[model samples]
Target: MSDVSTPDPRQSRLFTASELLGYLVLAAVIFIVLPSVLDAFRLNLFGKYLSYAFVAIGLVLCWGVGGILSLGQGVFFGLGGYCMAMFLKLEASTPENTSIQSTPGIPDFMDWNQLTELPWWWVPFNSLTFTVVAIVVVPVILAFIIGFAMFTRRVGGVYFAIITQAIAAIATILIIGQQGFTGGVNGITDLRTLMGWDIRPDSAKTALYFVNGVLLFAVLFVAHMILKSKAGRLMIAIRDREDRVRFSGYNVANFKIFVFCAGAAFAAIGGAMFTLQVGFISPTLVGIVPSIYMVIFCAVGGRLSLLGAVYGALLVNWAQTTFSESFPELWLLAMGALFIAVVMAFPLGLAGLYDDYLKRHIDRLLAPVDRMMMRRAARKTSPKAPAPTAQAAE
Candidate 1:
């Protein structure tokens, strides 16, 4: 009689330490190598891409994970940028002529419009701390109010999308209309300083870039942790079946509102970072078209995957920058085509496709080893199997 030891059940499904170590090593290599290999111009481009990635991460949580298609992320982003811009403007403006109400004290557009003083509401934004806090807090508050009203009323799907889009459009119009206050069509420019640092300096640009990089990683890590938590699982459940989750004693409205507020805050933070990098903020940046484009990035990237959002933002923005420089007229068309192709061919987005492809390839490669193990088990179990017969069969 032959005795054969059974394979350990735990061994079949567990991740070994070595495997975990390998994954960590791979991530480290990517983070270290990618920036080092790129040139300064490319690095700047990457900074912009990272900002877009931040926005996309928020969209993934709200729209992709939560089943809400928000087309007004640009408005939240603009709000953050405008808040930062307000601080920068206040800091840059001469204290002697601080009153924008005076003829020469107003911004160029306001001066052009013959406006004398800054609006009352703009007074609070003069404080840098208040402006910075408003950048984050205001968007969240707005998101909460909107989400509460909509979700509680059971307004979702297309109606939600349309309402958000309309909100974005109206915001753009209002900003443009208030030329004296917002700088109108030209937006805000001549932004030379941010928190007393000269924005035009390469050193400041590099510093901002580093700050952006840290924020991106921080946001990504937080998102990764959330997606792995119980709340994240409940979010997924809510997305899949809101009615069921509601019946299961979960506060579906609260979950939706939380996700929405979180997403808005993410977008707002990205916008603030973007304003620092670009040294300007404008109404066009928050227009309906740009907001729709933000949605396109999430769509082209796998909505369900965080990595997909990041990659989509990076690739699409890179393509836009490159193609727009060479063929400005065709840039939008090219982007639209690319989005269509990704949706049609990879429905899961590039990351999802890559993951599925890798999984299938690994399964295929392991099939032979699995068959060998099964054959060995059969041979050990057989009472009178002949070695010569097995060798002949082999």
Candidate 2:
């Protein structure tokens, strides 16, 4: 009789050994190979892109899987970046460090804007621990409020998107208007160091790059764990048939809130990392335009594929940087065409195309070798096959 206790294939199919290998390979490329090859300047750019990849990763969960399109994910990203920036600015604005400024205790921008005292809100960011926690928590709190209100009221689709876009615009205006507190239209700049370590050095950039990569994979793993849970299945169900999901007795709003909060946390962490790697954070990166561009990263990467999202962020930004530097005036026109083509031709993004066409071919190519390996494994495991194996060989 066949082995009765064989484990169900469904139980482990999500992350088979080969699939895990793929993830490992990707990690090595990011952490090991890329740093070794690229110059300091190029690698720093890559590191910056990786920071944005974190935002794309959040989009994969929030927008792609949950069927929630947040046109203002940049809000969360900006919140995180600003949290880090606040801490860094505080460190740089010590009385002794900024003795030259008219007001030595506050950031130079504050001095420039004629502010004499640190704002109460900016005071709490003096603690690195609080700054780190605030990076994730502040965004989650905002997301929770928004998701709770909107999902509970069944306000969704384009209306939700419009509201988010509005939030981004408002945030931009507020940051610019609050010049002393937020550093105004210039945003935050002249960040000197992080905890006494000079982040301006080439070595620090490389280290930060690896740090970003590792954190990214950790986030990706967490997202995968979530999607593998019952809640994830419910997310897919809601995405497909919201009425059916609601009728099944699930708290649809709660699920939306949870996922949205999770996405915000992920994006927030990314924003913090971005600030660390890039040496500055600004209002421009937190506005509606950047938020829409972020969505395109998820869309082009195949929203359903987490790994694809990282790649999508990298590729899109790389293209943006390359084309803008080389072609300047034509870059926007080309980007518009690319977006149209992606929407019209590859609705599911690049991952969908791979699944639809390339994956089958890959399986076909590997089938014979896989079969031979499996047969060898089975032969070794099976009891009486030993004697028959010699006769079969003969």
Candidate 3:
């Protein structure tokens, strides 16, 4: 047999030292290189992309690992976004600020819609603390209810997806139909400032972009921890063999519920941050179509890899923005083609591509260097050889 030793199993771990080093490199790029290189507008766009990365990472946990695909993730995202939007609108609608409107202390759209008084539900958003709480809590509560109802009943597969899709549709309809209450068909717009600070400035955008980057890394760390825990293994078990997992005396439904709720919360936070950075949230982002597209982000990223998800969301969204601005109609066609290719050709997405085909080749390339180092170490540790053989020959 060849003398080359086998690869260490530890190297394949989800968060191996080398894997962590990769994250560190990526973090450096996000926190250092990109900010230094890109202008304010480009940086702001990247910040928006990072917000989408949150959703994609959450999807990896829920759909990729737990095998619970939710098409209504946008509902949670929109809820969180609207919560933040409500708070910003309230700030912008102060008595002195909106004196020109019929209702001096209501959102511009509300005043335009001829509302003389603030809506009851909009009251809580007046407090930033409550709005922040609601951003996370609302999505978790809704996800818990839906998850409990369906998972316990053993409702899953495509049926669960359809139900989620229905929820997204209903939410979009409610928002569009209730013009006065829900910002109507236009959705929430004309957002400005946060706690008296102007959000329109480039400096503010840069700060928010860094904030987005930090939160994204935080999410990645949490996700990596989850995947490294026992619960993460159980999630995988439940995904691949649900009946077996149930037979193993585990409450598969509860596990599913936990992951699903976690996923919703992540998506919600992303939505709230999106509002903060982009300054608006509309039905366009929270509708079924958009939610479906979000799935494509996860699918393209390699749903099994958190880092892949981030990269996938950024690449796809960047491409979408670039192509849409330039080609418009052709962008849609290209995106559709990409979605299909991901499903059929690259089933495991970019992550799998790296792990399966590329990784082994990379290892092969490095093996000779590793062997050379090993030989050098062995020689050093071994005793020194005897002196020159000329004396022995004599």
Candidate 4:
């Protein structure tokens, strides 16, 4: 009989050894390998890429797992980023620093627009505590509102996606129109310090990169837990057959809302981290284009796998940077072609490729070694010919 303690790889559990190993490998890459190989600049760039990994991960849960394809994810990302940027902007806009401006205590953009005082909404962001809370809370609240309004009315699929895209467009327009309050098309730039610490130095940026990695792992852990839970299974059920799940007495709408809000929270955290590492937040990152790019990231990464999502975000952004430098005009076309190829050739993305081809081949290649080890183990545990028999020894 098989050892009861040894878990079958096929068995569903809270955490598998292979899954843990995946996490460790990812951690090593993010925390050790990448940092060792890359210079501070490149590492910072990767950190920015990792920030978007947050959105990709949330997509795994929302779109991949729950079948909720929100095209306005950038809205939450921008909200979180704006919250962090607001706080940093405030800290940088001390009266002494802005002494030349008409409004010595407000942001430079506000001053440029002839604003004599800080707006009431901007006042709360002055407190870092408030800003930190708002980063997650603001996005979640918005997600909850949107989810409730749509899901309750049984609105989903293409219609929900279109609505979300519309929201993203509206958000972009508002931010651009409110030039004085939001820094307009120029965006919130020239960010110098954070809580009195100079964040401009390479060392500080390196430190922030590690912090981003740590936070990403934390989010990954949370996502893993959610995936292993009953709610996660229910989410899959809801995604596959919403009507059947509803008929089974589960409140399908509630699950959808919860997952959507959770996804928004994840995206918001990523955005906040992006603001911290990149030192700026813009409406461009909040528009429909960036939102679609995020979905593509998830799709290319294998939306069903959290780690795949992270890899997807990193690889795609790295490719964008590399190609943009050489063939800037063709990068968009290249990206589009890449996406089509991935969807048509490998619907499951990178993770699926590994499982379907690479993983099986690897296991086959290792089979002989595994058998040899097992034989050796069995021989060692055997009786060894009964020690040549005590009676025959005489």
Greater-TM-score candidate between 3 and 4: 4
* C-alpha RMSD values across all candidates: 10.4, 6.3, 9.1, 8.0
The TM-score values for the models, in the order shown, are 0.82, 0.90, 0.88, 0.90
Clashing pairs in 2: none
Q: Which stretches of candidate 1 lie over 4 Å from their true place?
A: 1-31, 95-106, 359-394
- For candidate 1, the per-residue lDDT at 319 reads 83
Per-residue lDDT of 87-115 in model 1, one digit per residue for the tens? Answer: 77766666455454456554556667877
Candidate 3 global lDDT: 0.86
Whose lDDT is higher: candidate 1's or candidate 4's?
A: 4
Can you write out model 2's per-residue Cα lDDT over 1-394, one digit (the tens) per residue? 3232343233323354334545787788798788889998899898888888888888888778888889999999999999999999898888998899888889999898899999899989999999988999999999999999899999877898899899999989999999888998887987878888888889998888888888999998998888878888888998888889989998888998898899889989989998988999999999999899888888888899888888888888899999999999998898778778888999878888878977777667766554454444444444445587675674
List clashing residue pairs in candidate 3. 179-184
**At residue 174, what lDDT does model 4 achieve?**
96
True lDDT of residue 154, candidate 3: 97
- Winning candidate number (lDDT): 4
For candidate 2, the per-residue lDDT at 130 reads 92
Off by over 4 Å in 4: 1-12, 361-394
* Candidate 3 lDDT for residue 15: 51
Question: Candidate 4, after superposition: displacement of residue 367 in Å?
Answer: 11
Pairs of residues clashing in candidate 4: none
Q: What's the count of clashing pairs in each model shown? A: 2, 0, 1, 0
**Candidate lDDT (C-alpha), each:** 0.77, 0.85, 0.86, 0.90
Model 4, 1-394: lDDT tens digits are 2233332333345554456557888999999899999999999999999999999999999999999999999999999999999999999999999999987989999999988899899999988899999999999999999999999999999999999999999999999999999999888987889889988899999999999999999999899899889899999999889999989999899999999999999999999999999999999999999999999999999989999999999999999999999999999999999899989999889988878877676666665654454444434333443464643453
Q: What stretches of model 3 exceed 4 Å from their correct place? A: 1-14, 361-394
